[model samples]
Target: MSQTLDAAAVRSWCSLALDALGREREEIDAINVYPVADGDTGTNLYLTVESAAQAVEAVFAAHATGTTEPAPADAVRAMAHGALIGARGNSGTILAQLLRGMAQVLAPPAPGDGDHAARLAPALRRAAELARAAVAHPVEGTILTVASAAADAAEAAGADGRKAGGTRTDGTRTDVAATVRAAYAGARAALDATPDQLAVLGRAGVVDAGGRGLLAVLGALVRALTGEVPAVPPAGHRRPEEPAAPGPGSGPGAERDGGPAFEVIYLLEAGDAAVTRLRERLDALGDSLVVVGGDGLWNVHVHVDDAGAAVEAGVEAGRPYRIRITHFGATAEHPPEQVQRAVVAVVPGEGLAGLCAEAGATTVLARPGEPPASGELVEAIRRAHAREVVLLPNDAALRHTAAAAAEQARTEGVRVALIPTRAAVQGIAALAVHQPDRRFDEDVVAMTTAAGATRYAELAVAERQSWTMAGICQAGDVLGLIEGDVAVIGADLAATAEAVLTRMLAAGGELVTLVLGEDVPDGDALADRLERYVREGHLAVDTVVYRGGRQSVPLLVGVE
Candidate 1:
């Protein structure tokens, strides 16, 4: 009747939470009115939880050969770490801290040596407290309020249950189902009352969007522990008779309407002392400031007029990576206009996506095993908002998917051209030659020619003992693939990359491009070494490098 809070339960919680968020994402986005009103709160929370779920799955996969399952501590720690690194926007950042707080209590032994159900109350309380502390100025009517209410309800429910014969003869208290149900009910009530607490929500005739999302998450937790799906609430947390007010950012006194123009977020590796000072600096520089995470890692989020200054503060604090800065409105250089042509590219990582975006291409980020679906590509083409679109499927495996998306867009009255780019490096080459101002056919031909002329290779680790063109390779061997065939196998990343580069350069001519993945240790040094090797061995060849973020492979090589 009672589900124990073990590793399997944690895994199920992550999966269930993700599905719940996915279903409510659009409704939550519609109700987002606070902290900038960009209408992406739901999307941000979904991505954050998706990352956590993936991390938990990875832990289970790692123990596939072992007799014992992954420990609960390992699973929860991974979930918190994943959320911290992948968190986006203000609501998502606070949610990460909440999960981290729960992990603090759950990952270690209980103070009184209590059972798993007995730990739930304290975990919820810690989650609320830590989340409140993470925000620079804690708001009363947001997710923080709902979280605190849930904690209080959980504690109260445990106390009541113990008084009502819930405690066993051995002294174990209430079950997890009771605790989770109480928390979810309390959160739901808090969400409904948010309009009365927050002025903006009151004006908009809707409850707090972040609070509503938190309620959904707690509902999933209820299902995870009790095997009972909570009743779904109305859309946008608005009452049936209440007429909708103006949409966010449409009227006077709108929350964060004329606020800071940019939202900057990044993952920082820094000491606690550095973080303390860093928080003060960021608070002075912006509003909606939240610095979440600890133990030498943090996720820093802020809204600032000066995006560069916010980033500089992180640099002073420590090593900051996966930096994302989003503009809230149109820029001077790119005024709102219906374009004639646009490039839609499927890129492997965030860095490459940013690069392609800067080059005026609409980018769809492709994660390790999660390739973009045809519908997602179609959405990107729609987002491009152009008369003619050039689609680049960066991986060869996405060729048919890209074609389907193109055909779909064609039905929507958009001209589409699909470029057969077998790798990210080839996409980079095609982007280099793209000129939207040129004739549509001419531009397509130019991009196609550039992609075809570029020779591409990648560095990957063999998952198991396998036969290759080069020879037999064992698991953990760095296999250098040239034009999709294995040519060299080495023990080290730099060495294998070098071998791949040498082989590609033997028949090459002018320039070399290297894209380094996040997993590549000392990537800058490796890039420097490879560049030197190329300069010394090849005549009249130029070299360039780019950080590809967390791609599937260690290195991508291209020579033209």
Candidate 2:
């Protein structure tokens, strides 16, 4: 084994952590009793670490052309950044902050030749501190307490090694392997004692769910450093003397019994000062509040009755994207066993999100510049809380991301089918034909047929001079693209849209779908004009226009 911690070790650590979490996820979820008994702590931790692992792998991929692998600092920083933006629920949010803190200690570019092993103790300590600070109200006997105990033990071990002449009382320096082993041992001890420290765990006859998850992570770290996986029992397997009782706020009345009605999470871009104010405002509106990230980007997670108010607060702070709001109140009423099927779609705007939600699909909002990560898509699939799910990516660029999410969901026992809907308009067509009551394969085929039959086109304004299939266009020119290629360029938005629609209709169409973006001035007038043109030119065709607010393009046309 390598004596010093390095880039390869960080990569190994991430992969190992993800594996460990995957093994313990359901066990940990079964014992989830604190913060909220939604029973997703294990899954949340696994997803958070999966994001971190992917980030580290991306860093390695970026350096593949070089002579050497990425530096340890670069790898660790990538891991931290990935976790921040991709974090899911409350436990996931706190886990992101903890990784960020560790990265803060390990990612410095300068002071390159220091003892990396010695830094592990401080990194653990810093991680625990940052995690506790991120929570609105830190409670003991949870992941926070487990993390602190791990740090304390790692630090004590380091001290003891130094006291012994810094050479194991021999002639070799203390290695990272020893530090991680001590931390894992400490976390395991803390996890075992959590039931005594928290009343909920005691009543449930289980250790803290988050604590169990942290132990798995710490155990993974030990395996990454040394080549031995720590022997940690699954939470569900380790029953207390008494039969396990249902934890408080767990049954059908969880929401009514003082729990928040919804779980709101979003990624925000704001200045530090703005984020501070956002924290204050969110704290008053809900509980389980966690805001993690820095350097102008943040991930906000909280539980509240007014999901809109929580999101509005993020907007006031700055631009918030990839917004996800899940209704926990309804979850208690419909257990996982009861849900048979669901549709998960990626929409571009809040208006479209509302539209999809009304159609009984769980929506993941994709902002103009910021797209939802694969982890976010996976979380959305989980949130759908169904036995089978049909995923509509709605954009060609997201094909791979959607595929990866589908694979992940399948591993969690969700039957997922990925439909290649290349546009939101196509997604709309698919949703129109979605019938959850039908057989899963039959439903998927119907949605796919609808999406495929819809020929889509979009109208966008050029941001800079660019060459198109039709001709070269200058900045501020109206560009019309058909089926993902530029087909028309003009000075007027309406004229360009008409030209594109004419081309699409030349082949013959029965139905026309017009989605108007929020930015177009007097959008209603433009929609009316387009509707009139379609009606006049194609008398046999029907027209439908929708207000696709704040979408990426000025107009989207779909002909079927």
Candidate 3:
């Protein structure tokens, strides 16, 4: 039996929770009769867990090439952060808060935390308290009640352990496993009692949908600790003889009791004071208000009549992006519409950015000497709002980072394919033939083929004296690098570019594209002369030029 909650155990818990939610999503959706009976509690829960699982996977990927394992704190923090950014609905938002609360205590696992079990009781308690505080209107007979009972049971179990000589030599609790087991048992009992605590649940002949989701999560935690999966619990009505009246929140569009018309959510970059004010403003605007995350970044969610006003509030307080608005009433019976495909490319220059944008691809600008993190790529995918996505890293060094981002996006139900485009020109070539209407696999293959067929070269001034493949080059020497290796060294810009172009075409080519940087000397004249040379020396070879405006490199050449 497993006894400690290490990094691996945390990962296991997230994976198990996702699997459990997947198995029970439809059942939970059928019984969502409280706050709003939109029939998506199970799906939201699954999505929230998926995000958490992705975060854990990212943490592990970061350490994949290393000898040491990641600390439990690192894993826990990623899980919480993932949930905050990807939370879907009311229940999902509260679950994010609960994970955040647990992370607060478990992230820095105290000095004397010998066994992982000792930390479970306190984390569960903190999670319960924070989850309660996050909700605008606290209601019992729901997930809140179930979470609270679990905490209470954990504390009671701790007390029982103390009475049974559970104290360590330093007078600390010794039996953390017992406390966790008790908490899981208490949560299950609370879930069964949910029908009695709420009139809506009783009328609908179902348990609280949110409570059932929490029970599944807690049971996953138990399995992760002890290596024994629990039997799936029943949802909704226990007996066929029980009443099955339609939920009170049911109307023509399930907009019963005149609640908000839309659900608005976004990620905001703001200060703590601004967030406090935002909370107050949002609470007044609508019900089911949830603001989660910290340290300059936050995830805001609320149900409101005016979705525009809700997004405007975020803009007034701070910068908000990835704004998603859903009509709660209109889609009561129908699922959401899916976008076919999108491409997210990381480009080095503004010119390339515009080009990619015009080709129906989302572009991320790469600042000089500053690379983007995996989170930024994930955010870009979120902004695309498509079911299928193609990602272009545009740099060889970013292969690992791009892979991690694609993995994270996949967890959130996005189909992401990472194309290894080692240069911006290759990405440009790939985007030239993007077909959103085509099959996913066929489109990906076509893009990949375009990117692979292009042979790329760059012109840059040597930073310092160094020996290269061609010869020894001094600082200020114009260096021509082909396929990441220096192939030609010359004293003049025109001479070096001519030699590089000659060598590239020697391998044979039908088309050549030249990108001139901000500092390129005589840019227009150089491009004209190159085009003339290609036409004269290699018949039927076409040439094109664009103002690259990128730093460090003075010119880029791609031959296909």
Task: Rate residue 549 of model 3 by lDDT.
Answer: 67
- Model 2, poorest ten-residue lDDT window? 247-256
**Tens-digit lDDT string for candidate 1 (1-560):** 23767788888888898899878987987888786677778877887887788788889999999999998889889888878876877999999999999899888855464367788989999999999999999989899999999999999998888788755654556667778999999988888888788877776777787888888888888888779999978646455555666565543236556689889998898999999999999999989999999999899999999999999999999988667777777422223576999999999988898899999998888868656656558767866878999999999889998998899799889999999999998999999999988999999999999999999999999999999999999999999998899999999998888888878888866999999999898888999999999999986999999999989998999999
Report how far off residue 19 is in candidate 2 (Å).
2.2
In lDDT terms, which candidate is top?
2
Ranking the candidates on TM-score from highest down gives: 2, 1, 3
Q: Per model, how many backbone clashes are there?
A: 0, 0, 0
What ordering of candidates by lDDT runs from best to worst? 2, 1, 3
* TM-score of each model, paired residue for residue: 0.80, 0.83, 0.69
Off by over 4 Å in 2: 1-7, 60-68, 112-115, 166-174, 236-256, 332-341, 368-382, 385-388, 397-417, 435-442, 458-481, 485-503, 516-543, 550-555
- Among these predictions, the greatest TM-score belongs to 2
lDDT (10s digit) by residue, model 2, range 250-304: 4323423766888999999999999999999999999999999999999999999
In model 1, pairs of residues that clash are: none
Stretches off by above 4 angstroms in model 3 are 65-67, 109-113, 166-172, 238-241, 245-257, 329-332, 336-560
Task: Write down the worst ten-residue block by lDDT for model 1.
Answer: 329-338
Q: Candidate 3 residues 186-288, lDDT tens each?
A: 9999988887888777667778999999999998988888776776778766446554455455322343457887889887899999989889999999988
Per-model CA lDDT versus the true structure: 0.85, 0.86, 0.83
Model 3 per-residue lDDT at 493: 84
